[model samples]
Structures are given as C-alpha cells and as structure tokens.
Target chain A: MSQPRNREQTEQRILAAVGEVLAREGFTGIGVNAIAKQAGVDKVLIYRYFGGLPALLAVWGRSGQFWPRVEDLIAEQPDVLTLPPPERLTRFFSHFIDALRRRPLTLEVLAAELVARNELTAVLEEERERWGQAVATLLGGDDAALWQDHIGATTVLIAGVQYLLLRARKIRRFGAYDLHSDASWDALKASIAAYAQATLVRPEPAGHARQDKP
Target chain B: MSQPRNREQTEQRILAAVGEVLAREGFTGIGVNAIAKQAGVDKVLIYRYFGGLPALLAVWGRSGQFWPRVEDLIAEQPDVLTLPPPERLTRFFSHFIDALRRRPLTLEVLAAELVARNELTAVLEEERERWGQAVATLLGGDDAALWQDHIGATTVLIAGVQYLLLRARKIRRFGAYDLHSDASWDALKASIAAYAQATLVRPEPAGHARQDKP
Candidate 1:
C-alpha cells in the first residue's frame, strides 16, 4: 500500500511540474530533465512511470489541462441544448472565450503550435480534435440543420474567436477593441450574440427583405 | 557612376537574399552572415549598406513583400467603394485572401509572429498596421455606419480569414473544410459573403424580426 501510494504521489508531482514549467517557459522549456528538476525526483523515475516524454505529454493532454473538456462547458449551462440555436451558440462562444482566456498554459501551447510541429503539438492537436468533435456533437450533431447548412459560417466564427483570444496573448489591440480590457470582451460577447442572432435566425423571404445592395 | 551603380546593385542583392533565407529557413535563419553569403558579398557590406539586420528587415517590410499593399487590392477592383457595403466587403476579402495566398514568404512570417516577437516581427507589425489602417480607411474610413456599428463582426471575419489561411500552412483542414482545397476556400469565401450580407444589411425592425429564442 505504501509503495503504490508513494508512486501515485510522485506521478502527481511530475504532472504538476509540467504545468509549472509550461507556464514559466512555454513549450520550448519542456524536457524530462526539466520536469524531474521541477518535480524534485529522479529523471529515471519519469521513464519508468510514464514511458517517455511523448507518453507523459499524452497523459497530461488527457488530464483536462490542455483544453476545456466538453463536460465542463456543458456543466456550466445545464439546459444549454434546450435553448434556441442562436442563444445556444451565444452561450457556447461566451463559455468558450471565457474558458480559453483562463488557461494561459493552453494559450502558450497554441501560440507555439503556429511555428513548431513536433510530438508535443501532435499530442495536443489530437486532444483538441477530440474536444472539438465532442463540442460539435453538443452544439447539434453534424447532421443537424444548423451545422450542415451553416458549417462554413460556424467555422468562421469559431476560428475567429480562437485567433482573437490567441492574439490577446501578444498584442492588446486588434482593430478598435483593446483586448486587455474586460469592457472590450463584453462588447465582443455582445457582438457574438448579435452574430449568432443574425446567423441562426433565417431571414424573411427575399421580397420583404431590405435591399441594401441596389 | 559605375561605383554608385555597383553599390545600388549590392544593396538589391542583399535585400533579395533576405527573402530567400526567410523562405528557406524562416525568421530564425536570418543573419548578417547568412544574408551576405546568399548575396555572394562580404558580411561587412550588409552592415554598411543597411546598418544591420533590423534596418534591413525594416526595409524589407516596407518593400511590400511582407504583406499586401492596399493599392493592389483596390487595383484588382477599381469600383470597390462604389458598391454596396456588403458587396464591397466581399470583394475586399476575396481580393485579400487571394493576395495573401500568393505570398508564401508573407505567410511564413505571419506564422512566425505567433511564437516570437522581436525586431523582425516588430518591423512587420508596424508595416501591417500601416496597411491595416489603409484598409480600414478604404473600407469606409472607420467612421462610416458600417464600420462604426459592426467592427466586432468585421474583426471576426477578417481575423477568421487570417487564422484559417495561417492554419493552412500546417494543417490541411479546419472544421469540415480542407484548408488546402480550393473548394474549401470557396466555401469560406461564400460564408464570408453570407456573413457580410447578414451583418451589413440590417434585419427588419424588432416587430417583424424572426424570434428564434422562445
């Protein structure tokens, strides 16, 4: 019992150390030696317990620290699906923006992925894809009208949200909004609401629609 | 006269070499020695001609190679401003995407900017800001009703396009669309047009609006 408990404790410490090193120095600083030093353990133990760095990262990726888990996002709004599509989208983006903003380590890895692709990013990418598919199913399975018809538009909104949040890590301003300010984010939320409202709601028949193009 | 011409030619060669090295090895590979060697010139000439790497990069940034020039986008569509706001936006994005996709070097730098910011990115940032301002002005001077009210949506669209394009360098797909596929890009463009049409053309007054949230 003592041996198993001590091993569990050491694994937890090593995992915690990955987060610390990641936050302090970004992905470039991650290594077995670094993690062992930060964990206050022998480097050999890491190989014995986790197999190697890729496996260690894989475990960390599954630990819900890399990206927001679907369960957590849905947990925040118990009746999310019951809401109308537009409101559901607004809530989804609002929760997503909030979730990503809170994870500085995740943001760092996202930034690193832009330039470098290796085992680390590969593991994170797989994790993100899993989360992405889960969220897609939650938002209305891919076969649903909202997703099937408007996937392109949906992609734009989602990719846009990601870019802006990632951009915030480096620059404070993108266009008229100051990314560092909460007020700006609030306005962004409102815009998301407006966009969702506009997108999800089908426009009235062409004859009665306002003709701005002419 | 020949001496001055020879000096001017040397400067051109050094500048061209910057683009070559950048395309080959990215921002990290750029150096006085590398650029000089690529140009078939002495390393001292790079300093004497451009005052060092930062200055050389600044010159390159201004050369219209690092990002699209507003003139080029407008040149592709001379009647851009006369069109309706939605159509104008569609044309602008279409041209913008086409321009960016053509410049692999610009794309490389954009990816690099996400991870590192230094003299190279700083110089490019300033240049991009200059171009961004010009674009804003061209798209309605930032004071028009379209820009004043819908900047958030506009940011989402523009940034989404950028993110997707930058993403294509690494991953072939984003969402349901393959980033490398022209058809996928066409779908994105149509989505942009749809989003622009929805955003720029105000929906009917609240009484007549479709209520999706019940």
Candidate 2:
C-alpha cells in the first residue's frame, strides 16, 4: 500500500476501535492505550493522528454511527421539512431516538458529559444547537414568546428522553414502565410524540389555560 | 464522651465528612480511608458502624440534606395535598429544586450513581418511588390509562430537570438556558410545571388534544 493510504487506514482503524470500546465499556474504557490496543496500532499513532483521546472520541461521534445515520435520514426524507411543525418534530424525535438506541455509545458519551467537561462536550452542544434550530424553524415565526417556550421545552424533552434511556440501561424499570421491554419503549415514543405535538400549539399566550380544549 | 455516645458521635462525624468529601472531591474522592481521615475517625469504625462506604453513603442520603428536607416540605405543608393538582405539582417542583440547590452533595451523589452502582442508588430509587406515588395520587384515580401516561410524563420531567442541572454544574449553559443562574433556573422550573399541568388534563385522551387550549 502507498504510505499515505497506510496512514489513512491507521486513522480509520483507530476511530473504529474507539466506537467498539465505547460500546463495550463506555467512556471509562476510552483511554489512549486501550484505543491503541484495540486498533492493533502503535500508541504513538493515536497521538500523531488524533492528538489525544478527547479529540479522538469527538471525531468518532461526528463520523461514526449517530450523525452519519441522521444525515441519511435527512437526505432520504427531504420533504420532512414540509410537514406541519408537530409532525416534523414527531418524526425528528422518532429518528433521534432510533439513532441513540442503535448507537448506545452516544448515550454513554452523553452520560459522561454530565460528570466531566472536555472537547467532546462542545461537539455535543453544537449538534444539539443544530437540532434546536431545526425545531425552532418548525414554529414558522408566529409568536416569538411561544416559539422560545417550545424551543426550551424541546431541549428538555430531548434531554429527558436521553436520560430515561440511560437509566433504563441500569435500573431496567421505573414506575410502571419497563425500559427493557419493547412494548414500553413503543409507548414511550408514542407518548412523547403526542406531547411534543401538543406543546407547540399555543392558542393562549400565557397560562396555557386552553389546555382543556377538546 | 461515654462509649456508646462516643460511637454515635463518630458515626455522625463520618456522615458529615462524606458530604464534605462529596462536595469537595466528588464521588471519586470518596473512599474508606479518606472518610476516616476527614472525620478523624478510625477506618475500622466506618466498616463496623456503616458496613462499608456504600452503606455509609446511603445513610448520608437518607439522613443528610435532600430527602430529609423534602420530607419536611411535605410535612410542613399539609395543605399542599388539598390544592389543585397544578398547584401541588408546582410547589413540589420548587421545593425539589431548592433542596437540590441547597444540598449540592445530593447532586454529586446523583451524578456518581450514573457511573457506579452502590447502596446509594437503591436509596435514590426508593426516594423516586415515593415521589411517584405522591404524583400518582394527584391524578385522582379517574382514568387508569391517563394515569399511566401522566406517570411516564412526570418521570421525564423529573429526569429532565435533574439532567439539566447536572450538566449545568459542568457545561454551565445549554441551548439558551443558563443552568447556573437563578433567572434561567426559575424559567426552566416554570416551563416544566406548565408542561406537566397540560399533560394531565387529557381532554381528547389519545392526542392530548387539549394541549392547544389557552
């Protein structure tokens, strides 16, 4: 193989190894030596290519399972934007949940962010902002206050879903819902979708007193 | 101090020391020797009295700041149960946030639960069930299905608040909300409260169609 091709392959191997280790052991297992061992590459190569573990993990998040699949969803369903605000949000929530569920590493990385601050957090924040902008646009510039409120609500909703799933991995069951079971998962998604749809509609400005509307 | 009295004093000192260590160095700083050193107690006593660090931490959670204060709030405001569900929930959210803020150690303990499983998590889980029962009572036992939906929604709301505040300790800001500031925190609490109230009144049953009401 050519010299440059070998370097590129080495970098790819390191990134892939990071994902595998992240899946198995979460953020705790993503040390420099572990990545090198998993990749079967020299330790020097990790530093030479990625600079450090934080940067490497961030790269893995950006290029690995989560974002790539999200991008494809957006590409495959370009007309998702044309749907009503609530419908668009429901679709987005479903896609986002599926992505996180498939790539458990994403959820682990998010859990790690709660305890520690690193370069990876910035990437997470930026990706969150991208989704925020997408959701914000769904309101279509009607009532500024309501738009802002829904944006904040959306942030909480996303964080809530992620946190519940993270805990579900450990505790298995909370309240009457069984996180380990498929039926409960489907119920969770449906309930959140309905809730997201309802939150965006602001018939009344302040009290949400219109909440009893049939 | 007499022998039994001395033993009681040592246990109290050890529990207080755990809080100090949790606040100062976080869960990573917590260990058998470190607690003994901080409390000026013997390592043998910690094992003898509390059985281990996990049990000690669990004792601290049950006796120390957060849950104890919350129980007082419930006790002090006997009228809280009689008020409308929305009012009761808002009050509960406010008190819960205050308890968390006042006892930053509780937040640290919760963050620790994310990475490690110990006796502390079981205490946390039990506390969660207590609150869940309280919220369920407010549903008035009218519709079983609606009750379950609200239970799930309430779980998400609590998790969202906890996750945001946990992240605030590290990242300081998320989206447009500043988790560290009073104004932003109040805004978050109010938004969640309103969202929670809107969720319970299931006028349309399936779609939460009343959500758009003023």
Candidate number with greatest TM-score: 1
| Candidate 1 per-residue lDDT over residues A1-214, each given as its tens digit | 2234588899999988988999887776889999999988888888999999888877876674658877777677797878877788888888888888999888888877777666667777777777777777777733376566566777887888888888887766777778889898899888878877766654457644333443
lDDT of 1 by residue, B80-164 (tens): 7767677778888888899999988888888777766666777777677777778778887433664666777777878888888
Judge candidate 1 at residue A141 and give its lDDT: 38
Q: What is the lDDT of residue A174 in candidate 2?
A: 67
DockQ of 2: 0.43
Docking quality tier of model 2: acceptable
Candidate 2 lDDT, A1-214, residue by residue in tens: 2235588888998989988887788777778888888888887888888888877877876775354244544555788766666666677777777767776666777778777777777777778667555555543444556567666566777777777777776777666677788788777778777776667665656654355424
Provide the global lDDT of candidate 1 against the true structure: 0.78
Candidate 1, true inter-chain contacts retained: 0.55
For all predicted structures, in order, the TM-scores are 0.84, 0.80
The per-prediction tally of clashing pairs is 0, 4
- Model 1 DockQ class: acceptable
**Inter-residue clash pairs, candidate 1:** none
Taking candidate 1, what TM-score does its chain B reach relative to the real chain B? 0.83
